[model samples]
Target: QDEVVGLAGELRSYLSLSLPEHMVPAAFVVLDALPLTPNGKVDRRALPAPADEAYARGVEEAPVGEIETLLAGLWSDLLGVERIGRRDSFFTLGGHSLLAVRLISRIRQELGIELTLAKLFAQPVLFDMAGVIAELVEKSGRQLLPAIEPVDRGGVLPLSFAQQRLWFLGQLDGMSASYHIPLALNLRGPLHRAALIRSLDTLWERHEGLRSVFVAQGGEPHVELLAAETGFGLVEHDLRGVDQAQTRLTELCREASDAPFDFARGPLVRGQLIRLGDEEHVLTLTQHHIISDGWSIEVFLRELRTLYGAFLRDGEDPLPALQIQYPDYAVWQREWISGERQALQARYWSSELADAPALLALPTDRSRPAQQSFAGAHVDIWLDPELSRQLKVLSLRYGTTLFMTILAAWASLLSRLSGQEDIVIGTPVANRARTEVEGLIGFFVNTLALRVDLSESQDLETLLAQVRSKVVSGQDHQDLPFEQVVEIVQPARRLDHTPLFQVMFSWENEDVVAATKLDGLSVTPLETNYEVAKFDLDLALREAGDEIIGVLVYSSALFDEST
Candidate 1:
């Protein structure tokens, strides 16, 4: 009976992982024996189907009040579940950040009340969130503005803000190789190279961002969309007979990462497949940061797997058409940033960041270089489960989030290192705050420079409060591009350092689903040593199962290992 129960739980978990919530089986039954036919074969007709009582055992109480009912319906529809109980947790029901964005948008449309992602993080269960929504509805009825239709700029387009910065930096120093984003994966078991190539080609054809190139016309940068025939090709290397397969794969990854992109020409993305053995292979993907961000990588991997699976199963594409492309977003952003909304956001940022420190004075072991080299290494740190749990509790007590708590701690660390009361940390925001661009693949990430004063020795509680307020305000004005903010603030431009802030912080809570298992093959993320620094100090924190894992990336030219 114990073994049967364990197997049942495993089945449920696997279903949740692979299928929509509603599609998951409500219950499982264990058969003691199978009825046999007169010919001594098992009789399928004698098997009993699971009953409604079995499903009811797993169901929670139905939503009671009007608000609960409305919220339950929304959850059920978004999660593809037939019915949702008031006590059901969103995350447990396979709800992710992207789905949460869609849910919040739908809530605004249906309920006439605005909700933020932070609120969902705080109250994830149906009953709790429904109560919060009810209170919000009682206090004020608000409606969201109609989404802007994407503009069709038929001809040429301009570079995005992040892309423009990268373009100018490339012109300044062509040898700087830190702007490349490389991802490597290992595949075990049977693999189809042709199907993989086809899937990649589909991706290139679907997203114009991958087919874009930057060119300078009249000393100003602009993006040119190349012809469909001009696309990235996959390079193959066979190292099956090599004695040191791992080392050879590492060399290939380094070569791929070091290969510089020609922004002016075309095809800023490249792929390489290394065959380690008959059943093992390594796949490396490298793209210029101008065309991709962290979020775009997730989109690419997810779509690649979907297309690959469809092609492998039945030589046909099953993916849906993208409603909008990255270029459409680019055009929309240009127009929207010039409207009254941008001006209002600009006012908020200008006042909030006025007289902020130009840079974070982090102590370095070596002297700074004249021109920034962008060379860097990283150290990994892990927080134990107990401490991580305490941090979560503290975050709840302070009415904040794990991200805010981590940022507070990071600010304190920088203060101790620099002996400066005013510390500024730059963090990247997904900038896909709009529902239209949420699914599009492109460089939509914007950096937020959060300045916190840590001069006076304050308790953790007080520091958390201050950090929470600053983060909330920062999120409110996050739509303003970092480049424009820099132009507005007009910080002292130093050739050796970044403007606004030198140190950076990031918290990743989204769980990107890994590639589905291909027939007789298992795919997993491969660790690569493609080390290069984009900032003086960068800290990225990821929460995994009651523990916090952190990677500290520091500039090699600025600090030694001991420091």
Candidate 2:
């Protein structure tokens, strides 16, 4: 047995150096002799299966102290694992870029130790990450992040940096419907209208952002929370006798979504119910971007599902009371982002964006318009299973995420097509770094400008490394609002182009599905594509099974469909 163990260890070491990370065997077994067949040849079918430990990355080392225990618990919760060891690699345990961002946020919120994505990438093991945290805590004197607590509703509430930008834009542009976030859910069974109304009412009452409005007093924007007495109203549209009910339902959804909201009148969220038939119905909900964002959509659906289920069971509110509201976060952010911390972030961004190109020279079929146009269309692209698999393998070999690999390739393509080396692309990040705001329905998403220079003639691996480095650095300094970054960088102003980057790229790790179950209703989210393009060109990709599904949203004013 001792000799077999020794042989296994030797074989593991040899394989570790000879193969890629994904190909490395987690465990090895040695046989005393070969099982022979009738022909005196080794029989592969007679080989014994490896033990359960073969599935784990390495030998298990149980967590020791408090930090390790906390991290192990977080990993278990986030990764959906039963047990984790100190030596287990995060990526090997199904951790990806999105999960890594969440992990860092959790660590900062719980332990008050600020960490960077680069740091997490460098030390993915539980023990190693804990060690790094300990070192940072000691060096920083254990200064913790401020806890978000509910503020008095009577007090004046300020808008968050992100909200302020949206408000300014709306005020300047007359509340364009381009910033509206609409959700349409198709219910295939008997849906209790009373219960759905109660669920939505409870939702608005729970989140102040839903019942809030932006009003300018003395030429300054402020958020005013409405009283619960004025409850949310659900507009009912009976279309059972109409021809082409399904088709009409879609048109109504688009119309409702495109209608602009009045910021001064309050209640930025609107909901409508369309009765197509006895058993079929559609629910359409729209909110201004000033109040909600992409991540808020997930939070909204998850909570709605839970609330609807509980209501059907005659159960009270199953959700815990929120620690703080959107206004509280806005006030806290305004207070906390002052002084030297803000200065340091501003300096970093200014230096990073120094002398950067303001616009991408993408080839367009039409002459430039006098002003920006939102009219757009999307083209769908799919990568075959073989190509997707090869890309994953390449990422594994280079120790990078699939996002980095794809971004590098994309930047290379743009660089070659435009004859420009420096390329800046905008990407959104869920800025809910604090635990208190994780469940809140608000505009907490932040934009990141990742600039990459693809001038050098380098291999794909080299480009991947560069892209990875830029992404990590961007996440490290993501606390500063993109609005503030623009102020510090001071790019050349143009009426026809966006301020910093024209092209946007994003990877959706999960689809936003409003999956729920009432007593007898089949709930499925409906995809309502408004075809609104906020940028010159936007590329969004999401993984579906073994292939990659991509949508290229381009401004129709700049290019033709054939082009």
Candidate 3:
């Protein structure tokens, strides 16, 4: 418990560097040990809640009017809580941007009043929120509202180490496909090879993370950035496989995606827009996650519709000049996470993992080997809509969100299957909250090391709260990239110690690249011929409006697809 005090202090110091005064955790609850799921990691849900009650104390005045009563109920319902006193903070109750979006829509549809996600964040509590709603309703004589508009956050930001790697890897795939589209393109309008080349050059010149490379300097890998000339060739080939042109493009993009995309690489990211067939094409755009995020990709895709539309209309000149390159954002990010800024992060990462040696014990088909090899398989479990609704309602009732509910359910599933007390899982965080980094389509994806303990039996209500806290706290410490922690902590990366987690579990809501139906091509995701990695198994959980599906990817060399 004393150690928890120290850890909290450290976190407070680190938080001071970047977070506002109001956002730091006000309480810290420590225990003899954190619990784990079958996969063996800290079980946040199991972390004992502070016995002392706090944050529940509310304003003296109660809901004032009919609208206020209605608004408070809406907040409580959307947030999945029994009660939401006017002063209670929405953020403290697991309200994220996605939730905010949903909240706004509900208020509009139910209340016949309008609200913006930004407004909710700015005035995060029910009291303030009620006032905002009251004013809106008063201003508009009729029960009407404006349509929600999308916001574009712009700026260059630093890439986490994993993001750096994914960037280069995406590029390697780009090189193999003439740095743009796919074979289907050649089968169709047959876009000019020269035109594609021109686009990559333009894109690479505009983004800095692109031309970066990794080199061994003085026996250590270092970033060696290249001043890529704003010129590259785009080669189109026949739908027939194995051509010199396709081979070369494939090699470059895939290799680049696999390599280190760092500061050395200026802000030039590349991808191909290959026309695979008559109207179908594969758009392989690879940028270091440094400049982009999942949300950014959505923006890029939408913008691309505009750019390609322009190009198709012979209006190639409409593209805007970038305000700043990725490097500029990178420099700013580094400053935001100075020494003091990282202290609390360091505490959280080290505390739960201190000298702890264990495995979450996922069911593996292969015998335990001396060396750690990344080879695995994938299994998808889709939850039907009715169950999905149950999960959603349960999250709210537990003062949590669907994300936490899913995690608890997944941890529960893993425990039932593997019978491990400590479970470790990997989840991805879509880091796109800031108003500055929205438009840049790059990778800002991160793999979160989630620890769940399924030791004692917990009812659904308690379990949801536990899972909720874990996720919220995890988000607080997300700035520390996974790779950086691996190097510093020296976790069991090998099978014997298995310092780091191998089984990954992700929950997302993104539509397939081309959700809408299109003609002339199947446009399916093809499994590439990549080797099993040192770390195997990634399970992605996703939801669309009301549907939930889980997709698992593993190493083919080690595990059977059916298993």
Candidate 4:
């Protein structure tokens, strides 16, 4: 045992020199011989579990006090890991930017102490984070906002800032389906159709937004919560014996996705189940953007997985009852940003966006129309492992994130192509900075217009620094709605383009894009091609393994395949 332990330590140290911190194994085990199958392949099932001590490196220390214990528990819960050590790094344990944002939000919600992303990135270990939290708590003399609680459902509720903007756009566009948030999953196994329906119904009952709609009352949009009996209408089509089943399924999904939602009369959500065979099925769920966002998709899938599994196993609901619903948040948001707070935020945005360019003016294949056609197509791009690695290295050398480095490069490209040194790029923020709304499915995404002013001869490092500073500052004041920002900036309001910016850039983590698992089914996410564009160009990127996969969604009316 002692010799095996020594050997494992030596091997770990040797691997550390060559591998990245995240690539290193948390635990190591040594075996005398390999566990092989009859075909001479490694029998993964036969491998023994690494002992607890294997994960306990000599440098690791257990949580010492109450704060450390609290932080470790939060980390364990978020990372889905068991028994995290005090010295374990969050990133090394698979935490990403999304999780980092959630962590700070959680800390603020639970501890009443505000911490920044830079602080978390600087001190990721449980011990160091705990120490920082302790100091902040001790020095925090001011009172913090109270935790969000369930409000009386009898009163009329106004729409949230984000939701109100979406409502207005819907009015202007006349239910264009451009703001639909859709998720389609391909399932294979002994399918339980009845259980699936029950699970979805329960989900709708649980979140008020799923069953609710926006109703105009006294010339203002207000949320009207529907009854619990609201049916999701899980329409199932038997395509087992149909010709061209896959093609038919694709067409049906496309039609459902493109179907416009009427805010006045809506559950605002739809679900369709297509049976490819006795054991194979495809499920598509679509919701209006007024009710859901990207983060909400994650929450939706997670809750669906849990509810479906419990229902399948005849167990109790594993999820706890939500403390507050979407309507509660909408009411609270209006109350929270009142008096001088709104003016202060507006001033910050006005000053930051002063003298910003109105248009990106990218050369297009055709001339601009009087109004946006909204016709769009996607061009896929990939960065190989080598290039991705080099980019990470560049980010580290410049003291910025991979996102900042990539955005800087993107801005540089735009500047050179458009011959514009002043560039404004719109980016979406999760906007769930407060912990109470993190789990709610609503239109909580806020857009920040990152204006990067580049010199013709500016160096990469300088540009990256400027981008990072702007992103940080913009995020600091991200609470103000983009609609309000536009109203404050009051730029040229052309129907041909959006206000303040024309291009959107967003980065999504792999986990957010990955599919969820069902209890007894093989599940994979199905991608649908939409024929709409919300902006002139939207660059969405996600990391998969060692490479970066990107989709450039462009306006088909303005550019062709060659452009």
Q: What is the TM-score of each candidate against the true structure?
A: 0.80, 0.91, 0.61, 0.85
lDDT of 2: 0.84
Better of 2 and 3 by TM-score: 2
Off by over 4 Å in 2: 1-54, 244-247, 514-519, 527-529
Q: Which pairs clash in model 1?
A: none
Angstrom error of the Cα, residue 515, model 3: value is 4.1
Q: Per-residue CA lDDT of candidate 1, range 324-370, in tens?
A: 77777777778768779789888877887799888777788888898
- Candidate 2 local Cα displacement, residue 115, angstroms: 2.2
Instruction: Supply the global lDDT for candidate 3.
Output: 0.56
> RMSD to the native, candidate 1?
9.9
- The lDDT values for all models are 0.78, 0.84, 0.56, 0.82
- Give me the displacement of residue 538 in model 1, in angstroms: 1.0
Q: Across residues 404-514, which tens digit of lDDT does each residue of candidate 4 receive?
A: 888998998898899999999999999998877878888889999999988867777678879878876777677788998999999988898888988999998755535
| Candidate 1 segments exceeding 4 Å error | 1-153, 229-231, 242-248, 510-519
Candidate number with greatest TM-score: 2
